[model samples]
Target: MTFLKRGVPLGIAFLMGVLMAFQYYVPHEHSKAFLELMTRWDKIIAGFAVFIGAYSLFHLHYTRIKRRAAGWGYSFFVFVGAFVTIAFGLYNGGEAFWHDKKEGTMFDWIYMNIQVPAGATIFSILAFFMASAAYRTFRARTVESTVLLVAAIIVMLGRVPVGALISQYIPVAADWIMGVPNLAAKRGILLGVSLGAIATSIKIIFGVERQYLGGGD
Candidate 1:
């Protein structure tokens, strides 16, 4: 506290912090330069942040192995995954001076064939699980709950032709749910979210928030 309470860090933080906040409102050439400087600073900080995360990943596994913690094998899994990906992604093709050989092609293969299907499979299970959970937990506990459960079921069936064939009511209900009620609710949510974002941006501009600058304790 003694050193930092009265140091160069405090002065720089106050000055840069003012420019960071004011750049959002100020329209002069000076404000433009300040904004550009902040943008570059952001990219530089992000690069260093990535390095810090990588170091954390490496250190965590190394410590696990050193301590022989239970389920340490899982840590090895992370190490193996990272090493394999890096190895294939680096040496699979000849490298250009600047062009990345495996970034788009090889990594994308791993993502699509493996990650995308896994994600979809998990998402597909949600319907069955939702039905079971609603049946067990909801049980039409109240008028509001009953309405919610019915609405969920109707929307779920509306996506498929089978639902329409089974009952014509489903398609109509789904149309109302999606076209009117759901759309209105989504619009309200989006508007609220936008307002929140604008408020946060203004706060950062005014230096009311310094969490992003690593200046917080």
Candidate 2:
């Protein structure tokens, strides 16, 4: 059981990772073909993984509904929504899944009316949450915090037309702050994260990181 569950997966991971890493440096035709083959395999595996994830989600909600757990009513709505969408999508007005749904169909109607508005509503709610977070975060306690608070305020104001009416300098300084300091900081963070990810991937490839195998004896 240990050999089948752990050893085989570890060996495959090590080999695949090393092969993919070397493929970057060795730009031969064979290497390119290998990469293309792996990419196709990845897509196929990803499709199966998606089904697994969807099954897990539905199973969780179904259990909640079956147990009559708290907020089971919401779980009921989840089933309703999923079933309605799937029914409309599969109906497809006699068209196959690969083909686009014709306009005025149930699927198209639900997407434009229900899905789009729900997404927009979620985004609108997120704005209020962001404002609340900014309020808590941008307290002018220390010198660095004071500077951050001021910069955030400037950026917020400068983004709107009212800041121009207040003072031209406010907009100009905000633009300079964003263009210079913000860009430089962003690039530095990106480089740091990229290097860290490369190191972690190398460690995983070498089997120095075993967390992916799950925790057990």
| lDDT of every predicted structure (CA atoms) | 0.78, 0.90
TM-score of each candidate structure, all chains considered together: 0.69, 0.89
Question: On residues 15-111, what C-alpha lDDT tens digit does candidate 1 reach at each position?
Answer: 7766676687988998898788888988999999998998899999989988999988789888887776666566554563245554556656776
Mark the regions of model 1 whose C-alpha exceeds 4 Å error after superposition: 1-48, 96-98, 102-109, 125-131, 213-217
The TM-score measured for candidate 1 stands at 0.69
Write model 2 residue lDDT over 146-212, tens digit each, in one string.
Answer: 9888888899889899999999988998999899999999999999999999999988998899898
At residue 164, give the lDDT of candidate 2: 93
Best by TM-score: 2
TM-score of 2: 0.89
Worst 10 residues of 2 by lDDT: 93-102
Among the numbered candidates, top lDDT falls to: 2
